[model samples]
Target: MAYDPNNIFAKILRGEVPSKKVHEDEHTLAFHDINPLTPSHILVIPKGPYVSFDDFSEKASDAEIAAFTRAIGKVARDHGLAGDGYRILANIGENAHQEVPHLHVHIFGGKRLGRMLPKE
Candidate 1:
C-alpha cells in the first residue's frame, strides 16, 4: 500500500501531534510509545513517508537507511539496554497486524520483556 500522508506518524513528524521524543537526527526520529509494552519501549521512524520496512529500504537513500539504523542503536544505548540487549521489531503488511501504514521500528527492553509471539 502507498504511504498515507495523514497517518499518525506523519502527523507527529509534522508537529501536529505530541510525542515524548527519545532521539532524532537528520533522517530519523525516535520517541516513546504512548502505549508502551515495557519500561524502555520506544518507537523509531524515518523522517520520510515510507509505508513499511520494505518500502523504506527500497525508496530511502542509503545514507538515510544507515542513519535510521544508527539512531536505533543510539536510542538503545541511551536507554541503558546496550549491554544487556534489546529487541527491535518492524511489522509489515496486514498479516503482521501492522496497525499503522507508516513505517516504524519498535525497540523494547530495560527488563525481561519476553515472548512477542506464543511458543509453537
Candidate 2:
C-alpha cells in the first residue's frame, strides 16, 4: 500500500495530534492506545515512515528496527508489564485489520490476557 503521510500515527509523530505519550526516543515513540484491550495498552512505532512490517523490514535500517523493538521493551518494562508477561502484537495488511497503515506494535497486559488466538 502507498504510504499516506497524513495517517494518524504520522500526525502523532509530527506532534500535529496529541496522545498520551508513554516512551519516546530518537527512533521510536510509544503512547497509550485510545481503545485499549488491557489495563495497560500502549502503541509503539518507529519515528520513520513505515506502512507495515514488510515496509519497515524492506526499507528500515537494522538500527531502526532495533531501536523500535528496544523501545517496545522499554515501554513494557516502564509500565510494569514485563514482570507478569505482556503481549506484543503487530497487525499487518487488511486481513489482519490493521486500521492505520503505519507500522506499529501493540503492547498490553496487567490483567489476565486470555488466549491469543481462537482454538481450532
lDDT of each: 0.93, 0.92
Q: Which 10 consecutive positions of candidate 1 have the poorest summed lDDT?
A: 110-119
Predicted candidate 2 versus true structure: per-residue lDDT over 1-120, tens digit per residue: 678899999999988999999888888999999999889999999999999998999999999989998998888999998899999999998899989989999998998888889899
Cα deviation at 26, candidate 2, in Å, is 1.0
Runs with alpha carbons beyond 4 Å of true place in candidate 2: none
RMSD of each predicted structure: 1.0, 0.9
Clashes counted in candidate 1 amount to: 0
lDDT of 1 by residue, 2-39 (tens): 78899999999999999999898999999999998888
List residue ranges in candidate 1 displaced over 4 A. none
lDDT of 1: 0.93
TM-score of 2: 0.96
lDDT, model 1, position 38 = 83
Q: For candidate 2, what is the total of clashing residue pairs?
A: 0
